[model samples]
Target chain A: MAPTEASERPSLERLLATREIMVACGPGGVGKTTTAAAAGVMAAVKHGGKVLVLTVDPARRLATALGLTGIGNKEHRVPDEAFAEAGLKSRGELWVAMLDTKQSWDDLIARHAPDEATRDEILANPLYQNISGRFIQSHDYIAMERLYEIHSEGRYDLIVVDTPPTRNALDFLDAPERMADFFSSRLLRWLIMPYRSRLVNVATKPFYQIADRILGTEFLGDISEFFILFQTMYDGFVERSRAVGRLLADRRTTFLVVSTLESVPLREAEFFAQELTSRHLHLGAMVMNKVLPEYLRGSEAADAAHTMAEQAGELGGLLSERMGPAHEPLRDSAQVTRVLKEISASFLNFQTVALREAEERDELSVAPEVMVSVPFFDTEIHDLGGLYRLGEQIWE
Target chain B: MNDLLDKKLLFVTGKGGVGKTSVATSLAFLAASRGQRVLLCEVDGKGDVAGLLESPPTAFKEREVSPGLFAMTMDTEEAMKEYLRLNLRVPFAGRIGPVAKAFDFLASAAPGVREILVVGKLCYEVREAHYDLVVVDATASGHIVGLLAAPQAVNSLVKVGLIRNQTDWMLEMLTDPAQTGLVAVCTPEEMPVTETIELAGRVRNETTVNLASVVVNRVLPELFGTQEEEVFETLTRPDVAAELELLVGSDTAPVLEAARLAVTLRRTRSVHLDRLREAIDPSVPLLYLPYLFTRSHGLRTTRQTATSLGEELGY
Candidate 1:
């Protein structure tokens, strides 16, 4: 189970071995977070290095399994004892950090602010408070900023980061560039200009009048004051964001697009993969999770199901008579027939879905370096053992 | 509480990939088929509503995709333009280009401005009585709270002006239980259920809108009852399965295994369903929609879902 061993098939293990950052991103509700954690766990156990998983949100039990409970904005090492508890031994350290968006934003402001007074004032600003707390795109921007900050520290050999669920998967990829542009835009200058100079030119007068009438003078003043306070940190913020953007485009950084075989999410993931290629970022792997079992697609099984459905009465009578002595429940021919019909119908129903999934797989337009399919587990993956089992399927 | 469709405005939201758009489209379809004039607006502008309806793509201008059913995709910039044209009466159409560009920048920087535009447009439809009902395919659970609370957020920030004045009526419409309601859709799974519960709490505490109902989508069918399940177990035993294979002239193991998988999946999901039932307020109706075992998703699937929804609503 050595992740470092070379195999004929390209595996996530081999991909993680070469990359410094592996970003797990896709449409939401596709087990992106769990896949990211499993990759981090496997890399630590098999590749023998300090592996860190920076995740936004994980299921309660999975978080507990990784010992990430109630800890935010701080990285915690997954103690060796937990691996022992899960009946495993890790060859290297594994760390986990949950992204705290508000805290991350405050930290970014603290880092970029020109002075302590400016930092305090910005932090206390109601507008700043609202943006840090409820701004949707702020989540996208801060996740990348935190990853950049963590990677620059050189603390781990590998960082597997799970992206926040975005309206569009491409949002985070463009967040840093957007942030940089926002700081240096001419409109931003115009926004804060009138307040600083107390003079409105003819060209800007209409803009001012409309803004004043629409948003009110008081609200406009609050916005002006917030931006003016933000102006002092503009250069630092712009430089930091650009560096974050560059880090994403670095050779060692790669993206893993996780998705299910469902049509809507598959379409979104395909668009994401294409976008990554278009942006010149490395698309390392595409892990399709919760795939229906291959056995469900076998012609032999389908034939059996069809036969059972067609001759349930005769089959039930025959089998019940043969097994009536050992199983009393089989003696009831009508009930046994019902059971046979139900199971067969259920099987045929699932076969249709499995076939649909196969068609969706075939229609996937983009191919990454590696494509992996993980079968749907009957039970939820809520523990370290479950994660390990899931990881092994994609490990090759 | 059962008057879900009777409300003038209904915002359907859920975690992504949980069939939120499908549920919203189905609700609109269901309403329209019941002889109600319905306007369906997609707030995210993903054009999923159009795909679900098998109609041409929707845009800022609402189009009649079906008889008595109109669909549109929300564009905050277009909404702002419409607002300027209608409310401000400022005939600056030639000059709106720069103003819109500037406003787009402001919408990005200012927290609730864009959200307010979307909510304001929907509320305006309700106010003008443009349709018997308006169904909005709103943002996912993660952002819906912010979107629903935008008017209040704007009110707290803006002390005076036209935008401030506009918030009063929108808030009035949104806060009224009879006029507005929110439907939270989710599947009986771990993440979607967890998020639905969390969203329920946030919507109750933070927003003025009413939680009209919770739609549990993709619910698996129970394959067997107690006695039948016992018989199924006995049939799955190795000796019985081997005999059955001989009789059927094919390997029955995979067929049986698929059934077992289905049963386990249903059992696991039922636990989460129970948790969701316990977590949500008892007064809010829980609507269950079966998992459609169809070959493709299109108008056919939408019709099936709408039929199921119609039955759930006691039609």
Candidate 2:
């Protein structure tokens, strides 16, 4: 059989069209959020698919980029005029949602609680309130739940997710399972066993007194009460968390590892790539964002620098003379020459960075994964117009 | 800079990739250069500081990486072990399996317990008379707030305990302006600047952590003044492009492109820097770290940046 058309387009573009869920994950400060937004916009405008971009713990940037009032838990449609101005039209629609971890936690408890009284009790527990509200680990789990909840609704053809800049990005992959494990761990059961069976408590009284001396009697009582209440909903938490984990492992879902070609981020990207493989998650693409443009590579940069320096005096004289004698003070020979020399030096400096970036990209591209290179723009992308420019390059 | 030196602890944080590790290490280097005994602790298991120092990776144990400068990556488990060994003074605090598991459960169950252990360890060092300065390379954004606010969170949750007393000691050191200060790092970009502003506000309102200074990293210098920008605007004309052939001997394309990028970057960067200046508190100092154009962003560049930072701080 002849080669299919899907094999012709770049691997990343094909994945964008085919995959139902695309997760953009990377080390911090690699423009992962913008890349995810741009990809969603691209899929919506080009592939004729309804898309929803989800961002967890964003720095309040996705809203400004999508031209929305705010990026809360609610999904909002990005105005079509913004796309129209960029000379693009979305055949379907584009939606944006930011994960509100607290709301998600409350919703999860409400869904799992056996009764309203139990839900109220869990919500009011000081330990429960602290962990669900303040812990970043809970956000990772809730974000997955929210993703699965929205994906299961089948309201959108594509869902793009931007994860938090975690020190260990793989934590998101394992958080659901870990949360379930913690809930069902023998340690937790043992800690709460006394409350469940009064007979077991009598046997472990010596252990409880020892613990009470270490962690005060009141603290122990508070923890035992908290776990006793939590035990009622233990099966529900484990089952739902496992469902989220299964959703992540679904064939339709894939992860896009994003990073710059800098040494540090490249190392992180490799770690993510390896971790994803080990976890058996589908690798959609590796987006190498902010790869410096290779303006002058190898010996050319040095040759160009030397030639520019040699011609600096002549260029300075001509430009000053062209400006006329009236502006003589403004065209000081020393200053003009300084600017000329500095420009060449700056070019050489940037070329070196670009060259190093290219080498790093080469190292990452050796893997079987699809690598998409995005040139660093001079300006930070913060709006639809910026996203349009970025979207154009993401597909390139 | 001397003002910063007087601080018992300096917590350096920024949006990721804004060079917090390098900034924290450079600050440690500068402090050590000024004859201070400095302990540079990397929190959250981020061991990149050791790599940047061109030294072996620092484990849980502190090692003197440079003259009068020590380094270690804070390990929560190890910190707990140390806390138990030192506080309880039990012979088998680490070896006793049952007791260790109990402490593990206690540490794991609480929300901010790990953070408190890390912050508490930093405070423990600050209190020791041996070290004059301790620099904590904290995680970025919300995590930094979480780390700094750990003491208060634990304090409010546990009304009375050895944990309360430990965190209270940490809180005392952290809340004192002379004892602890925070250096907010950011680049001249929209997200980083906006995040820095939000972080500064949070640090001010939520905790007594002194917002010592804002270090704007990789700032493009003003290569073009108003007159030069006006002059260059004319240069973009087609007429000038043709005249440029006579000005420079053979090729003008490379020079033109580089000059164009310089102008655009300078103008673009200034916009965000202006926003940062307006958003940050005027009383808090703002320092700039110029873009280091070195071939390798390794130790040499870090040392050069440290020198510039030290100079800017008047060390």
Candidate 3:
């Protein structure tokens, strides 16, 4: 590694400056979507590059956070005025989109089917509707497929992807391969063999009788028919899946594993990092979000405690004066000390959280090159102002 | 807790990162403490329940993580194998590598099939009455509705078959309020609360799973009354330094700053909590869990949370 790369932190600004693609991945509730949106804003405003953020969760969370209404499968540009209000004089634009799994599935079939007849046949199939419409992992496969499709267009300088929740994050990576394998599997091919040969159908009648006893005749026919139609387009689908695999493996694409200060997400991050390494994907940065700021620690903590103890009487007087005769019980010195102590305790709690976050970061020495930390925010971050403020922190 | 414990199956789900694992573990522990045999299951192979219970991770096999409490992770493949062995009576389904591979292909090729196997297995467990209560720590809230509706979706799609019969049985168990309950977990934040509200509506309309309650996790305490908050706000001003000189006879800047930040966090949480309270339907019971300030979310902290939650439920 270059000395510059070795020494410099893996901050969002660096990623925005150079990387074409950034996939924000982490456990659920770690603000992965928020981080991805913030990074997109950072890339557009600070780096003077056009950015696109793609989110895969069915919820319109990114759309809601960006203050955009009704995000569908298509790219919805965040208006210039929203960015202007955020005090960002960006030379580039930011566009956001949510993945529509059903739409993507239809689009994939439209692209890969050998002919209109075959496409219509497959799309009209009941099994195809159930599989393509409700297949849980299809979202994962189609998300990557959409990413590959959008990236090839060269429309945006940077694309930030908000992945599915952590529990299924790896599915997004593996589903494409699994989809391709399922299509090309020998078992499926053999199951559909009778569809191509009348002679084989005649020979397999007894076999069908026994199999129908187990899987039912209607299901057997549905499976065979669905596979026969799907088999016609198998080559096109497999090729696209392999292409998506290559695109994810491209050098320009990077992954930022987002986690929080806690043990569960950090442990999940470690597992994610290992999987990325095993898959030979570029692990760009490890972003630990929601880290509590270290307000008071060690001697400063003691100082706050001492100051609270000294000011207990005056603070009591202040609250007593404010509360008047109705709150006489609250004016006691003992009550005052308890309130002040709570304030100090909150600060100390934050200090402990911050320290623990640092310890968790230290444990991630395996992928120590690009690490960024975002502090926990007190206020809710919604709309352009929040994104801009969060983007500034990400850039920092 | 009694209402939830009474159901043979309880499915707990929430937005990503809303502490569903903790909530599920706490509920299971609470039920087990009430002397009910509780089986806690997690889908998506996260092993969060196992991790929180400080037990070694077990996939597809229920292990006694705590007394009267069992934990298991539902693997789609394992569920598929189990479904075949029990329902189809395929003798070699469990051990044959080719059969497993073919089953994986079938599941992958069909979208809702995997969900059926996993959810069907869960519903099957409930029907079998192996445990007095079964708690499934389902996938995040976003996908949970889809998981719950899978059996019905498959049932409606397939006309007549062994698969249909299996799905029909699972659907029957799922929709019966006496047989199943759905607990939605959330944090007092905009996204999680909004998602939880949406999930509640979906659960009511789409699935037979009863919306038992909403567990709001990681809530901060409201430490400041209106007047105290006003005083705190005034103290944050730089001019308060003059008053500090006379009162404490020293720089109270640290004290004021710490107090202000702490109060701000509480105020933020309170505002969000208000939003959550308003947004959620009043008919639904809202349970709040305080944020634990421990360094790690280990077993002891989890047990402490469970105890507090049990007390709150009056179990």
Second chain TM-score for model 2:
0.93
Give the range of the ten consecutive residues with the poorest summed lDDT in model 1 chain B. B92-101
Fnat values, candidates in order = 0.90, 0.34, 0.39
Candidate 2 retains true contacts at a fraction of: 0.34
lDDT of 3 by residue, A210-305 (tens): 346545767777888888888888888899899988888998899988888688778887888899988889888877787766554455555655
TM-score of chain A of 3: 0.86
Off by over 4 Å in 1: A1-9, A196-199
List, for all models, the DockQ compared with the true complex.
Answer: 0.88, 0.46, 0.44
Steric overlap count per candidate: 0, 0, 5
Weakest ten-residue segment in model 1 chain A by summed lDDT: A194-203
Ranking by lDDT: 1, 2, 3
Collision pairs in model 3: A28-B16, A28-B17, A29-B16, A29-B17, A135-B111
Instruction: Report lDDT (CA) for all predictions.
Output: 0.91, 0.79, 0.75
User: Across the candidates, what are chain A's individual TM-scores?
Assistant: 0.97, 0.90, 0.86
* Residue A120, model 3, lDDT: 91
By the DockQ metric, which is better: model 1 or model 2?
A: 1
Judge candidate 2 at residue B30 and give its lDDT.
84
lDDT of 1 at A162: 98
> Highest DockQ: which candidate?
1
Candidate with best TM-score: 1
